[model samples]
Target chain A: MREEPSQQIDRRAIRVWQLNGVVTTLVFAIITATLYIVKGQYNWPDFVSYITYGLAALTSIYLLVAIFVVPYIKWRRWRYQIYPHEIYVQRGLIIITRTVVPISRVQHVDTEQGPFLRAFKLSTVSVSTAATTHQIPALPVEEAEQLRDDIARLAGVDDDDE
Target chain B: MMNEMRHVHKLTIILYVFQGIKASAWSLIVLLFLGAGSDLNQLLNLPFTSFQLTLIILGVFLLVLIVFSWLRWYRMTYQLVNDSITIKHGVFIRHDRTIHKRRIHSINFTQSIFHQVFNLTEVQIETAGSDLEVDAVLKAIPYQEAVALKEKFLNLTNTHLVEEELPIDGEVEAVDEEQVEEEQPIIKEKKISIYHLLIAGATTGRVGAIFGIVFLLLSEIDNFLSEGDYERVVDWVSAQSIVAYFSLVFLYLLIVIIIGMIGYVNRYGRFSITRESEMLYIERGLIEKKSLSIPVSRIQAVLFKQNLFRMPFSLGAVSVELAGGEKDDKEAMQTVIFPLLRKKEWANFLKELLPEYQEDLSEMNHIPRKSFTFKALRMTIIYFVGLGVVHYFYSELVLVKLGVYLFALLGLYLLHRIPAFRRSGEQLVMQYFQVVMLSKEVAIVKKKDIQALETQGSRLARRLKLGYLNLSIMNNFLGRQFTLGFLSEEQLEEISEWYISGHHD
Candidate 1:
C-alpha cells in the first residue's frame, strides 16, 4: 500500500464543523417543534403525535453525533501533502478517496473563506486543473494563502493546451 | 486579407425565416389545430370566420418572420483582421467577438440544399474556448471564398504552431500549406462503401429507440385527435384479418429498417477521412455536405465502441474526444473518426490514423474474478432489499420479481466479464461497459491530458483489496471522468504510482 499523506488539516476544523452541526441541529429543532404545533392545532391522530416524538428523538441523536462525533472523525481522516510535481489529498469518513493532481495540469489556484471559516481565521485552498478542482479545506489563513501562491507559481512553470 | 466587415450572402434571410418557423413550430401547431376551429374562435369575437382568422394569423406570422430574419441578416457581419477573426452580431446587443487564429482548433463547412442552390457554404469556426456555441459562423458565403479562408486560417494556425515549437510528432509534420500547395498529397484515405453503410445501419441498434419515439409521438397525437377519432383509428387497425395483420407487421418492420437505412445513408453516404500533413479531414453527408478539418494535436482521447447489436458480428466504431468545441452539437466535440471497423482492423486503423495511440490491447489485465462475487453480492443485497419492500406491497408480482432477478444477474455477469485496464508508458487504456446494455467502450487517453487521478475504496472494498480508479480529462469547461471499478489494490497502486511519479519501481 502507498504511504498516507503526511499533513493534516487545521485542528480548529473540528470546532468549525461542530458549529455548522449546531446550526443544522437548530433547523431540525424548528422542524420538530412545527410538527408538534400542527398536531395540537389540528387535533391530529395519535400516529401524528407519535411521528413528532420519533422525529424529536432522531433530532436529539443527530445533534449528539454531529456535534460530538462526526467532525472529529472527519478532521482526523483528512490528510494532504504537496509534492514537487503533484498534490496528494486523502479524505473521507467511510469511503476514503485519494486523489493525485499533477502540478503541470493545474490551471489555477485560489484561496476562499466563508464567514465561518473567516471567523476561525481559516481558509480553503482550491487547486483547479483543466478538468477537476481539489480543495484542501480549513487551513490557517496565512498557510492557505502561501499554499495557493506556491501552487500557482509551480503551475505557471509548465504550459500546455487544454 | 479582408479587413473590412462583410455580411453573409443575402440567402441568410431566407434561411433565418425557415429557422424562425422551426423554432416556433409547436406553438403554430397548437394555434392552428386547437384554437382556430375551437371555442377559442367564438371567445375572440373576431370579424372574420375561423378559417379566415386562421389565414390572417398565418399571414401575420409569416410577415413577422420575414421582417425579423431580414433585420438579423442585416445586423450580423464578420471580418478578418491580422491573425484574428471578429464576428459582429446580435440584432440589438451588437456583440463583437474576436478569436485569434492560434486558438482555432477546427473549421467545418456545411453546404445545405439551399446553400447549394446559391453556390454558398456555411462556415463554422471552432476555437478552444468553453463557449456553448461555435466561436463564430458565416451563415452563408460563396463556396470558393470559404475554401480560401479555410486554407488561410489553417496556415496561420500552423505558423503559430511553428513559433511555439510544440513537440509535434515526427510523422505528422506541421507544414505550411501555403508553401506546400503544389505537393500536398493525401497521406491516407478511407471511404465507407454502400455495403458497409447497409451493415452499419442494420447494426446501429437504434430500432428500439426509434420505436419508443414513434410510440411517444402517437401518444402525443391523442391530444390533437378527439376520443371518437382515436377509437375509430384503433378499430380500423384491429379490424384487419390474421394474414393482413402479419403483412402489416412485416411492412412496419420493413419501413423501420428502411427509415434507419435512409438516415444512415443520408448522414454518411459519401463519408471519407483523409490525412494530409498534420490535419485529418472528414467529409460526409448526402443532402447536406459537411467537411471538417481537425489538427492532430487537438485530439484528447480515442474511443473504440461496440454496441450490443454490433458485438455479435465483431463490428465496432472509432470516435475521438476533441479538446474544445460546442457541446450542443454532439458531433462538434466528440466526432466519430471511423464509422465502422472490424475488431482485427482496429489496430491497423489506429496505426494509420492515430499512430500515437496504437498499442497492443490484447495484453490488458482483467479485473480480479473474486471482485465480481463481491460486486454481485453488493448489487443483490441492495436490489433484493428493495424488492422485498415492493413484494410486501405487491405480493402477487412473482413473475415481476423473477424478471428483475434475472435482469440483475445478466447485468452482473456482463459487468464482471468486461472491465480491463492497462497502463502503457504515456497512454492508459481502459476497457469497460456502459449504457445499461453492455455496450463495450475501450478508451485510450494520454497521461498529460488527464487532469486528475482518483482512487476510492469503501471500508468493505479496502478489506478485500479492491478499489475504483477514475481519470478525468478536459471536456469543454468541465472534466469528464472515466471510471473502472473493482480493480485490485495492486493494479490501482501501480497505475497511481505511474501517474504520480511518471514511472513504476
Candidate 2:
C-alpha cells in the first residue's frame, strides 16, 4: 500500500530546536546591543544607523518566533521511514520535501548524536550511497539503532571502507 | 611465477611530445599575446640579436618538455598481478594504484592518426571509483601486447568475455552450451550514417568556435596596433564598409562550420556499437581508430541530451554513464551509445538494451495552478528588481523596460505549460521545464535504482501547501540529482507516496 513517510522524530527535538533558536536570538541581540553601545560613543553613518535599528527589531521578533513558533512547525513536518527496500524522509520548513533512498544502492549506514542530542536521548541515522548521504535526524536512540540495522540488513551492505 | 611491473613502449616519448605541444600551444599563444604589449619590444631592444634570442627561447621550451616527458616516462609502470592490475606513476611523489578485476569499469584503446602510422595504441583502464588523483593510463603499447594484456585482464575475472574463447569448466553439459553460445556471440552492430552526421553538425552550431578565436585575436591585434606607430595599418583596415565586414564574418563562420562538420564526421565516421556476451564494444574514427570495451552491468544509465533545434526533429544523443567516468557533455559523446536518433526510436532502442526501463511517457499529469502562480510571483519579483536596477542605471527607457518585462512574463507562462511526468511499472521519467534554457530536459530513472529522495519546503510554501522534490541516482559520478521546485500539495502527496513504497510487479 502507498502512503506518505509516516514516522516522526522524537518530540524533544522541538524543545532542542527552540533552545538552539533562543541561543541564536540571544547572540543576535547581544551583537545589536553592542552595536547600539558603539553608536552611543560616536555618530554612526545614516545607513549604518538605520540598519542597526532594523536589526534590533528583526532579532527581537526572531527571538519570539524561534522560542514559541518555528520549532513546533519543524517538528510537525519532519518524517522518515526505513522500508524493506527503501528509506524515505520528508522535511522542510517553507518548502516540504519528500526524499527516498533505495536499499540496493546503499553503501553503509551510521548512527550519530551530538552532545545536545545525546542529552535528549536522540540520534541521527545517516544512510550513505554511491552518491550522497541522507540523514534522519533526532530519532530516539534505540529507534535510530533499529533503523540502522534494518537498512543494513535490507541493503545487504557489509562494513567495507570508502 | 613472479609478476613483473612493466613500462609502456619507448615510442611513448614521441607521443608525449606531440601531446605536450598540442596542450601547451593555446597557453603559450595566450602568454605571447598578453606579453606582446611591452615584453616583445623590450626583447627586440636588447643588445643580443633577435634571431639568437628566438632560438634560445625555443630551445629552452623544448628542453623543459623533453625533461618533463623523460621524468614521467621513467616513473610510470604497470603490473598485471593475479586478479588485479597495479600502476605506479608520478615525477616526484609516487601514486601506487591497484584496481581489482571486478571493479574495472571499462578498458579503452585510442590510436590517433600519428599512432596509427606507428601501430601503437594507448590503453586507459578506468575503475568505478576513479577521481582526479589517479587515472590508469598506458601511454603507448604495441597492438599485440595491448590485445594480450586485455585478454589477461579478462581471463582473471572469469566472466563472459566474448572476444576471447576460454576453456569451459569441467562440465560436459556446460561445454556443449558454451560451444553453441561462442558461435553466436555478436549481439548487435549500429553504424552512424552520413545523413545523420549532417543533421547533427548543422544543428550543433559548434561553428561559434571560430567566432571565439577571431574575437580574441581581434582584441589582441587592437591592443598591439595602437596610435603611436601602427596608425596607418589601422586606418587602411578601418576603411571597410559595414556590409563588407558582415560578409567577412559570414564567410569566416561558413568556413568554420564546414571545418566543424568535417571534424564531427571524422570522429564519428563508421561509428558502431557492438555487443558480444556481456561486453559492449564501441569502435569509431575515420583517421584514428578507437575501441572501448565496457561490461553491460557497469553501465549506470542511458542519458539523453538534445537542444531545442534537435528536439523539433526528434534527434537526440544517448550516452551510457559509467560510475566515476568524466561528466562533461563534450567528453560524454565519447561514451555515447547513439549520437543521434528520432524520438520514435527511443522506446524501441531502450526496450532492446534495457528492457526494464522501457516506458511510454507521451502524456503526463498537468501540475496544479499553484505552481504557475508561484513561478509568476517569483518572476514578477525578479522583474521588479531588474526594473529597479535598470532604472537606477538608465531610468529613461521606461517603455522598453516594461516591454522586456512583458516578454519575460509571457515566457514564464510558456514554462508553466510544459512540465510533465510519466511512469511505467518500475521506470519513471520527469519532463522538467527549464526556464533559463527554455527547453524541457528529461530524467528517466528506475525506482529500484534510485539512491535517495528528499522533500523541502519554506514557511511561505508550507502555508501555501507546496514543496520541492529532489531525488538522486548512482548512475553518474556525483550521482545525478533531479529536482523539481514549487510542486503543489496534491502533487507533493502523489510523489511522496510514490517514494515511500517499493515498486512491485
Candidate 3:
C-alpha cells in the first residue's frame, strides 16, 4: 500500500485492443483453415479434422469474448497517477501488478507507434529504467509526444529527443 | 615497467595446462559432434591413411594449445604499486589495466577445492561502478600472500583476521592469538541452529526437486512391475485401500522434506557472518569451504525475501545487492546474510549491516484505479500463456487441470495486492506484494541512487485518465526499475513539473 490509488488509461485505447483481438482471431482462423485444407489433400486421418474443428471452436469463443467483452474492462482497468516525487502505475485485472516509479529515478522518455496504432493516429509513450522498460500504449500522436516531454521534463532529463 | 615485471607462482603453469586440456577436449567434442572427425579419409578425400593424419593434426593442435597456454601464463603478471593495482596479461597483444585504490570497492579472496589442495587462493578486486568486471584477478597465490594482498590493497592490517582465517581447514597451523585481544573482538552472530536450518532448507527449492524425482520414479514404475508385483499391489489395495493411500502420501511428504533438509544443512553448514572492522566476512559450505570478505560501503541494496510458506511463519531471507559481480555467477553465500530470519529480527540485523538505510514518509496516497486494470492486462497475458502451455502438456490430467485453476485463484488474489510507493523529499519508499509467496517487501532507496525516470501512456489509458510511470536506480548493469500505472493526468503533470523544475540549475 505504498502508491496512492488512481485512474484508468484512455477509453479509446480499448477500440485498438478490440481491433487487435479481431485481427488475432482472423489470423488464427486463417492458419487453422489453411492447415486443415492442405492436410486434407494428403489423405490425413479423419480424426485430425475433428481436432482442428475443436480448436476452431475454442479459438472462436476466446476471440469472441476478447473482442466483445474485454475491451471495456481493459479500458476501465488501466490507471496511473504521478506526484511531484513519484510516478504510480497499477493495471491488470487478472493478476494485478502495481509499479511505483520515482520521478528522480527516471532516465529516458520517448513515444512509439505500431502499425495498428499509426493507422489509428495514436502513439505509445515508452519509459526506460535500468532494469525494465514501461509503456503507456495508445495515445493520439501529439499527446504522446507531449506526455514524453512532460516525463522527460519531470525526470530532469535534458537530452529530450522526441 | 620492465624491471617490475615479476613472474607469478610457478603453479600457474599447472593451472594453464589444466585449462588448456579442458578447452582442447571441448573443441574435440564439438568436432566429433559435427562429424568432421568421424572418418578423416572421407572428410579430406585423401588417397592414403587419413587416420594417422587426423591423429597428427590433433597432436599438433594440442601442442599449439599447450604452447599458447604457457605463453599466456608466462605473460600474466599483476602489481600493487602507487596506490593502484595493474594487471598486465596477453600473449600476442598486451593489456595493462590499472585501477586506483580509491575506486577499489571490494577485494575477495577465494579458493576452490583444488586450490585448497595446493594451498593456493585467488584474490579478485572490483573497482567502483564497473559492472560485471573485476579490476584484477591474481590467481594461485599462497593463502597468506592473498590475505596480505587484500590488506595492502585496502591499507588495513589486522592480526585477528589472520588468527580466524581457515577455520577447521586441517593443514593450516593455528596462529598464536595472544595479541588478538588488542583488536576489537570481531562480532559473530549465533551460529544458526540446525533445526531452523533444516526447516528453512525444506522450504527452499529442494522440495520441488524431490517431488520431481518422485514423479519421475512413478513414471518408471511400470519398469519395476511384473505380474506378481501387480497382483500383490492389488491384494494390498483391496485389503486396506484408504489406509494404504494415506500412508503412501505421508511417506512421500516425509521423503521430500528429508531430502530438502539434507541439501540445506549440507550447503549452509556452519553458516556464519562476522563483522571485523569495516568489512563483513561470510564463511559457509560443508565439504568445499568458502570464506569471503566484503566491504560495508560496496553494498547497494538489501532485499528481504520470503517464500510462500516462510511468509506465514514470518521467516524471511535477506540478500544484499552487491555493486559489481560477474553475470550468472553463483556466489550464493556471498549474497545471502542468512537464509532464515524472523520478521522481528530484521531491524537489528539491518542496523548492524546498513546504518544509512532508513525510510519515513510524512504522508501517503493510493494508486489510481486504472493502474490495476492496465496491469491486469499484462498479468493476464502471463497466466493465459502459462495455462495454455500446461493444458497442451497435460490436457487429460484432471488433477493438473484443477492445479491450474487453483493457480488462477492465486493469481487473482495477487493482482489485488498491487504495490504502492511513497516519497519524502529525496527518498522514495515503496511496499509491494512480490508474486512469489505473496510476500510483502518494503524498499527504500535514495533519490541520488536513481539512474532514470519515465512515464508512458496508451491512447485508451489516457482516455481513462491513466498513465504508466517507471523509474530505475543503478544497481547492476541493468538498473532496478520500479513501475506503477493508472495515475490521473493531473498527477502525471505535477510529477513532470517537479522532476524537471529544480534540476536546471
List TM-scores of chain B, every candidate.
0.86, 0.81, 0.68
Residue-level error in angstroms, candidate 3, position B288: 3.5
Instruction: Give the per-residue lDDT digits (tens) of candidate 2, residues B242-344.
Output: 9888998898778667777787778777788776666777887788788877777766656565667677786777677666664323553236777777877
Model 1 lDDT at residue B358: 89
User: Which parts of model 3 are misplaced by more than 4 Å?
Assistant: A1-162, B1-71, B129-135, B155-191, B209-263, B276-278, B326-334, B358-411, B414-429, B436-440, B452-471, B483-505
Instruction: Give the docking tier of candidate 1.
Output: medium
- Provide the overall lDDT of each model, using Cα atoms, as 2-decimal numbers: 0.84, 0.72, 0.67
Give the TM-score (vs. native) of candidate 2. Answer: 0.77
- Residues B1-505, candidate 1: write the lDDT tens digits: 6789999999999999998999999999998988664465688776777888888889999999999899999999889887788998888788899988778877899999999998999998988877766478889999998987887788444554454444566523545444366354548888988898888887776767676676687679979999999999889989989999899878877777777878878887899998776789999889999998878787778998898878888898888877777453354346887888887888888888778888888888999987888988888898889888988898996997889888988878876888898889899999988765457889999987888999898878988999998999987556778889889999999898888765211
Cα lDDT of model 3 by residue, B377-444, tens digit: 76677766886897788778767766766686667556545556666665665556655345565555
DockQ winner: 1
lDDT of 2: 0.72
The better candidate by TM-score, 1 or 2, is 1
> Least accurate stretch of 10 residues (summed lDDT) in model 1 chain A?
A153-162
